[model samples]
Target: MVTTKLEIHGRVGVIFHAILEHRHYSADQPPESLFQFIDYSNKCLETVKRSVEEYCAAKERQGFFIEQDNLSMFYETLCVGYDWNENLEDHSPTAFAESSQPPLPLPLIQQQQPQPEESEGGKPPKINLSQQRERAAKLKYKDLADYFDYPIQEAARLLNLCPTVLKKICRQEGVPRWPHRKVKSLKKQMDKVKDFMSSNVCTVEESASLQESLNKLQRDLDITVAGGKIAE
Candidate 1:
């Protein structure tokens, strides 16, 4: 059977002690040698498995859990180290590998920006965001409330989305298993805002502020109705 989760505090302790030993006994070695040693040790750990009782025992002793994302980042750093090692033709590959220079700093993660097509001439194409928002806002909170009266699958079908996606939206909105009552409550709140905006009791600045608040509430309600987090 495959291990869904693993606790490796003992393994980590061993590695930490080994690193300390290396630093003490082989003080002249470069940082790259230590990185290579850790990578080799991790590869060895990949083949081992522990029973449920053993895993629990390890957790009780000193638990360490590596999330999937962190593990991926760790592998990325290892790849960089391996590439650095491959580039050093003259350097000896050993536990006591010698180098006078310091190890290169790990590369920073850069977000990938959207690239323009060949026709765009380095400029991103114009997107009619207002029109998109208008379409999303078309499904009023009351209508959404009404839609939820049906089964989840049926309501999702009416909204032109799968049930799973609709449920995800509800979860994002922090509503119950379904958001019928939530939508109805938002609808009532919006109605109150509109009614207050129409009354002759506010100044221009206050009216503008009220309008902004209404727009924000509309967007929040529409996010649930739209069944996805549509970026502005």
Candidate 2:
């Protein structure tokens, strides 16, 4: 499940408070326990940073990009308690040790062999529309939303459908209007349910459970579509 920014903020606050509460240190050197807490805090921050960067990249691929400067400013503001600044130089022994390490050798085996010929005129290869739509047909709207970041145009291109058709699918699938007050709530719920149902099914029992979940989702879609038809 995707965690909200406020939830992340609260987690960081708890971690900071715990560190301060248990802190025991000296002017010349910090206690070993302090190092452990600091390491844990760094891990939490690093995880959040990686997730944000990945999310930003995915959004950019779908024609949306967030400002990096704002993220930088937010990070720096959080570091104020540690007296961090852009002008500060790293003089720590750990930094020196890391910098002294030699680079590792390159991989001996190439995973991807080079294509024999480039596309003519330097243009990208065209997508096989039939194959693309076939693959899309196997995917649920929830799956398509996650893969394409919920942009109607991107999903439409893959599914070989117009924006209006995709919107109709969304309605049949019971996904609320994208412009509603809880804009992300619908997407987040879809992502959570679909991912959970698809993952970690090994035994027959688990497989049956997954099947039941899929059937339920299909039933909901059918009912919505039938109701709409009757209303018309």
lDDT of 2 by residue, 166-228 (tens): 454455556543322233443455556667766775566766776676666555444433332
lDDT per residue for candidate 1 within 46-102, as digits (tens), equals 333333345345534553331222343432332332323332333324443423332
What's the residue-level lDDT of 44 in candidate 1?
A: 39
Residue 133, candidate 1: Cα error in Å is: 33
Best by lDDT: 1
Candidate 2 segments exceeding 4 Å error? 1-123, 147-150, 154-161, 176-181, 184-232
Clashing pairs in 2: none
User: In model 2, how many backbone clashes occur?
Assistant: 0
Poorest 10 consecutive residues by lDDT, candidate 1: 17-26
Number of the top TM-score candidate: 1
